[model samples]
Target: MKVVAADSSSAILNEKFDPLTIVATAAVLVDSPYREARGSLPEPIYADANKGYEVIVHEAELCLNLLEKTKADVVHLDISLGAISLEELSPIQFTNMKISTLGKQHLLKILPRIRKIAGEITRKYGIEVLAIGKESIPVRIAELTSGANAILYACEKTLKENQPVLLGLPSKCQPRISDESAYLYSLMAAEHDVRGFAADQSGVLEKVHISEVLNPIARGFRALRIEPKT
Candidate 1:
């Protein structure tokens, strides 16, 4: 008897949106404090983490619930390890985890298992489910910087699958500098996608960098159109 309230601020409520617009949610282990209910919201919300691998199944179900409620075109999730530890660590420890290759690899290993949940949900709902690690870009720490590249990769993968899933990205990409923590890549990858540069090799539509694909600025692009490639 869990009830998830719809917040008006949710992007899914937008009347006009990009065809690739996706809903994003985070998947964490059960008993995670980061799952705290917002604004006295009801208990048993999907944000509540489930322990162990059960989290994958639980989050997949939650995604479906969200889809049913919002009729969202796509749903994507940010999967993470150390669900409990993520919130318990000190700032330095938390900061270190963002750049730790071993930490990311450990989390990446869990994605395949979770992708199975996406497959299951796809069959049942006829919708696409996309997943990416929170620290999807291994080379950069997203703590105070941007993760445009990782977002682009996930978006490309989602388009290839013809599934709707949230494309996780930093609101803004920061400039690269001498600070060791800064992301080395430029923000063009994300900006390019927003500008509507896309590619279709056979039939699947993939987002292309501004430089990678011809700019669609002439006619303008708003949504992705699925059509057969001739």
Candidate 2:
């Protein structure tokens, strides 16, 4: 099945390829300290940087809405427990929090709730929901801040040989080789087609099988030199 791994960092999806299905995935990071003015999740909603789960039910509804808009065939949601918003912390602080005993306790406390939310979304939407936890993730990607990369990687690997996987920013990204690119390129030698690029090459484009491309900054686009299955 053709699948588009959308970068949901924004409210709108901007993928160039058309797929039979779209994948929306994220982790629930409980935001604990918004007042510190230092390291923390964006705001009240620690898990969803853009939208927090005011109530588990509300979060599920929001998921439904997003699915409707994206016309997604399935949703893969990863719940990252005890993961702090380390955006502004020092290296020491980040390391400390990641390994802190208390932090893990906090993560354990909220895991059940996160699972409930995932269940609600699955039941309400009648779509496949792959609820991923931290343990299931690849050690390399799990060492990072979120499970987005792992989710994308799993999606890419699940495809049969010759299946196409569209990779794009799920959220607003830095220049090139951002975390998103790291995960996308991770699937380069896999059994799927990696379709996405920025204005500037991330420097690893040549490592993968990419016979087709669309301009990164162009408004309108048309696929160029699409590679056919062997």
Candidate 3:
């Protein structure tokens, strides 16, 4: 089945390697073989890290935006609520879930907006939007896709601001640059071929130098230090 999914990844890190802002969000369409994105829509948000929950609304909107370009059997959201129908999700229904109080409150605040978008997607395209989260391979692809695009965005930021950016990648993923594109490949077992890539049409990769480093605070997560080439 063709699946569309959305996720945000990477971050602008502080001196202490704590994330300050989320760098990019992506929506991808994946078909059978389920290895990589067939098509994708990516956006650079640079949103505050403390307000990370707010990015989901943008992710949903990106999925909707992507649906305009291609057809899909379903849309998967990174909400992680048992693959429930996002269009029908109600605040009353959240009370019984095992989520923490803060997370529940955050979802409650965004439910109306998210449901509105999900309803539109369902009504316009006759496909359901599921809150399947990370368990769905498509969502994992979206995360990698977003992380790949985040590398380009970080390079642009570093060049424009004349400073450096520390980017925290998605868990257990590594980056590879080929031709004019940057790609993030899943390192998790059984996902050997699952990967995502972003084109560097503007040649951002040439303008910056990137170094990989292990995240000191977050195990299993890697980071990139991007700086303008001197």
User: In TM-score terms, which candidate is top?
Assistant: 3
lDDT of 2: 0.31
> Using lDDT as the measure, what is the rank order of every candidate, best first?
3, 1, 2
Candidate 3's error at 147, in angstroms?
Answer: 0.5
TM-score, ranked from best to worst: 3, 2, 1
True-vs-predicted CA distance for residue 211, candidate 2, Å: 27
Better candidate by lDDT, 1 or 3: 3
Task: Give a tens-digit lDDT track for model 2, residues 14-128.
Answer: 3544322222332222112211111101111122332322223333334445554444444333333233321222334434543467545444454455456556555665554
Model 2, stretches more than 4 Å misplaced?
Answer: 1-63, 79-106, 133-230
Q: lDDT of all the models against the reference?
A: 0.31, 0.31, 0.94
Error of model 3, residue 137, in angstroms: 0.5
Error of model 3, residue 184, in angstroms = 0.5
Against the true structure, what is each candidate's TM-score? Answer: 0.26, 0.29, 0.98
Q: Taking the candidates one at a time, how many backbone clashes does each contain? A: 5, 6, 0
Candidate 3 deviant stretches above 4 angstroms: none
